[model samples]
Target chain A: MTYCVGLLLNEGMVFLSDTRTNAGIDNISTYRKLFVFEEPGERIIVIQTAGSLSVTQTVIAKLREADEDPDASPYPSIMQAPTMLRMVEIVGQVLSDVTADISAKVDRMSQSATASMIIGGQRKGGSPRLFLVYPEGNFIEATEDTPYLQIGEHKYGKPILDRVVTPETSLEDARKAVLLSMDSTLRSNLSVGMPLDLLTVLTDTCQVQHQTRIEANDAAFQEMSHAWSKALRESFTSVR
Target chain B: MTYCVGLLLNEGMVFLSDTRTNAGIDNISTYRKLFVFEEPGERIIVIQTAGSLSVTQTVIAKLREADEDPDASPYPSIMQAPTMLRMVEIVGQVLSDVTADISAKVDRMSQSATASMIIGGQRKGGSPRLFLVYPEGNFIEATEDTPYLQIGEHKYGKPILDRVVTPETSLEDARKAVLLSMDSTLRSNLSVGMPLDLLTVLTDTCQVQHQTRIEANDAAFQEMSHAWSKALRESFTSVR
Candidate 1:
C-alpha cells in the first residue's frame, strides 16, 4: 500500500509520496516513488506513482528511454511534451502498456500487477494542472471545486483535504496540510511507512522550487507527531 | 454505506453509528443501525450493523422474534443470553442465517447485498468486551493492543484513532474521539451522513450509562462540527 497526494493551487502544485513498497508483510522495502522530468526553465513535470512497483518503475524507465532515443519523433517524450495535458497522456500510455504486458503472464496466478499515477506540473506559458492517471490509460483533471488528487491509502487522509484545501490556497499552506494528512495516515496504517519524497513547484517558473526527503527519524516530523498526539488528548479532555 | 465504531475502555464501552443509507443517490433514507438488548442490571448487548440494509434489518428482526418466542431453546436469544460471548454467538448465527438466505435471492439479481456488525458490552460480573462480527458469522475480539472495532467507511476516520485512542482511555474521552472521527468521515465521503446513534456502557455496570441520538439540527453537534472546522484551519496555519 502507498499514499500520494498532489494539490493544484493558485501559487503552484505540491506533490508528496511515501517510500514504502511491499509484496507482503515480510517483503516490505523502501523505494522512492517521485520521478521528476525537467529541462529546467523549459518544462518541469513531477510524477508520483503508487501500486505495483514493477509496473510504475518500468513505465518511468520507458519514458526516460524515449527521451534519450536519438531518432524520436514529433511526439518525443514527457520532457519535450508541449503542455501538461500532453505530458499526462504520454505517462498514461506508458503505464497502461506496461501493466497490460505484466498482467498477461500473472493472470493465472491470482496476482494483480497494475499501477496508477498522479501527474502534475507546468510548461512555459501554460497554466498548472493536476491529473489522476488510471491503469487503463485514461485520466481526469482537478477542477476548482476539487483541487487535489490522492491515490493509494487515500481514505485515511481524505477528510483533511475535503475540509481545508482549495484552488486558491497558497503553496506553503497546501504543503503543510498534505504533510499532516500523510502524518495521520502513517500513524494509523503500518502498510504506509516513511522516508517520504516531497516536491513543491511554483507556477510559470517551470522549475522545481523545493524538494526534501524525510526519513523516519527526522526531527521536524517527530515534533509534529508529538504535538498532534498532545493536541488530540487535550481536545478530547476539553470536549464534554 | 455506513460508519460504526466500538471502543472498550477501562471505564466502559462506547459505540457510535451513523444513520444514512443510500441505494442510489436518488434513493437515500435514514434508518437506525444500532440495536440494544438489555435486561437492566443483568446484561446489555449493543449491535451496530453496516452494509446491505436488507440483510441487517432481517437479521435484527429474527433476533427480536426469537426473544419474543416463549419456547426458544437452551441457546436463548440475545435478550436472554447469560454471557456477553453467548450473546455475540447468537447474534452472529442469526446474521449468518439471514445473510445466506438473502444472498441466494440477491445474487441472482447482480449480487450486491451483504452485511457485517460490531457487538460489544458487558454481562453481570464479566469484563467489558468488544467483537467485530463478519458476514459469515466468524468474529474477532478487540485486544489490548488494537482496542477498538469499526465496520464500513472505516479508513477515512482511522488516522485519528491510530494517533490518539488507547485501552486506558476514559469512556468520556473515547466518546469524543469517535464523534470527531465520524465527523471527519462525514466530511469526506458522500456514502456516510448524519443523525448518529451513540451509546456508552460502563464496566461491571452491565447496562447503558449514556445514549444519544444526534440529529443534523441538534445544537450541540452543530456547535462541535463548527468548532472542529475552525480548529483544523487554525491548526494548519499554526503548524510549520
Candidate 2:
C-alpha cells in the first residue's frame, strides 16, 4: 500500500515515504505518512508509517495528543524524550497498545488494520539513530553494517539499497538512492503511488533540515525517471 | 523459497529459476526448479515451481507418468497436449489437485505451503504462450501488456522486469534482463539463493533453444553481479 525507507548515513539520516492509500482498485486517496515532531534545536523525530491507515493515524494522533497534553509528565512526548532510542521505545509502546486495543474490538478484522512505524532522528545531546518499530512493540536499530530500514512494499526497491547504501554515504546520495529505489517499485507495482514525502535530518542539528513533497509531475523526478530508463536500456544493450 | 521468471518474447520464451530450498536457515539445500518436457519438433513445455516442493514434485512426477503410460486416454500427457494453452491448463489442474491433497494434512502446520507454477511453451502449430498458475488451479496468461510471469520470491527482483521487460523484447535481451533481475534479488534476500536454471524456447521451434545452469562460481554470473553493483553505485551518484 506504501513504501517508506530510512537511511542512516554519516552526513545525516534520510526518510522517504509515498502518500498513496487504497482500499481497492477504484477507491484511492492520498495520506501523508511522515509525521515530524520537532522542538526546533532541542529535538526532531521523524516517524514514517505503513500498513493500515487507521492504526498508523490513530497512533500518530495519540502521539500528538501527548505532545499537546498539559498533564504530560516528565516523559512528556517524543519531543521531550531524552534520546532517540527512548523516543523509539515510546512510539513502539504506543503503537503496540493501540494495536492491541483495536484488535480486541475488531478481532479478525484487526488484521486489515495493523500498522508498523520507522522512527529515526536525533535528540539534542544524543547521536543520530534509526529504528524499525514492529506492530508487536519490538524494534531494531540500524548499525554501520546495515544502515537502512525499509517498510511497506520494500522488496521491489531493495536491490539498489543493498548495492549502494552504507553508513558513510552522504545525505544527498542516500536521498537519491531511495528515490530511485522507489521509482523502480512505482513503475512495476500499481499498489504503490506518489506524491512522496522526503525529509532530511542533520545529525546533532536536531531540527528539520529539509522537507519536500514530490508530486506526480515534478520535473526533477521526471528527468531522473527518463535518465534511468535510458541508462538501463544502454546498459542492457551494451552487456552483450 | 525461490525466484523464477518466465518471459514470452518475440524472439522466444525465456525461463529462469533459482534452486535454493530451506526448511530453515540451517537446513538449506539445492533442488532444481525448472522441468522441461519436449517432443522435439512436436512441442516443448517448461514448468517452474515455487512453494511446497513436495506438491510440485508430485505434480511433475504425475505428468511424467502420464507421458509414459500406454493406456493414457484422450487427455494424455503434456507431450500429447493439443496446444500450449492446454498444457498450461493440465499443469494448473495437477498443481491444484496435488496441493489440495497435501494441504489437508499440512494445512495445520502452514497454510502457505501450497505451490504455484509458471508454465510456458510452444506447440508445433501454435505461438508461444505463458501462464501463471495459482494454488487453486486457476491461471492467467501473459499478454502483450504484461509479458512476464514470476513465482516464489518475486518482488525482490521485480524492478528490473518493470523497467526493462516487454513482449516485443528480443530473446537475447530478455535473457540478460532476467539474469540481472535474479542477480538483484540474490544480493538482497537470504531465502532466494543460487545455482540458477535458465531455459529459452523459440517460437514454432518446438524445442529448447538454450538452457543454462548457472553455478555459484560461474564466471559470467560473477562478472554480471559485480558490474551491476558498480552500475548501481554510478547511477546513484550520477542522479541529481
- Which candidate number has the best TM-score? 2
Q: What DockQ does each prediction reach against the true complex?
A: 0.59, 0.66
Model 1 CA lDDT for position A195: 92
Q: Summarize candidate 2's per-residue lDDT along B186-213 as a digit string, tens digits.
A: 8888888889999888888989998889
User: Model 2, range A36-138, lDDT digits (tens) per residue?
Assistant: 9888888888999998788899899888988888376323587767667778888888899888888777786534457888999887778889999999889
The list of candidate 1 runs beyond 4 A from truth reads A70-75, B70-75
Query: In model 2, what are the clashing residue pairs, if there are any?
Result: none
lDDT of 1 at A84: 81
lDDT of 1 at B95: 81
* C-alpha local distance difference test of each model: 0.86, 0.86
- Candidate 2 residue-wise lDDT at B11: 81
Model 2: docking quality category:
medium
Residue A224 CA error for candidate 1 (Å)? 2.1
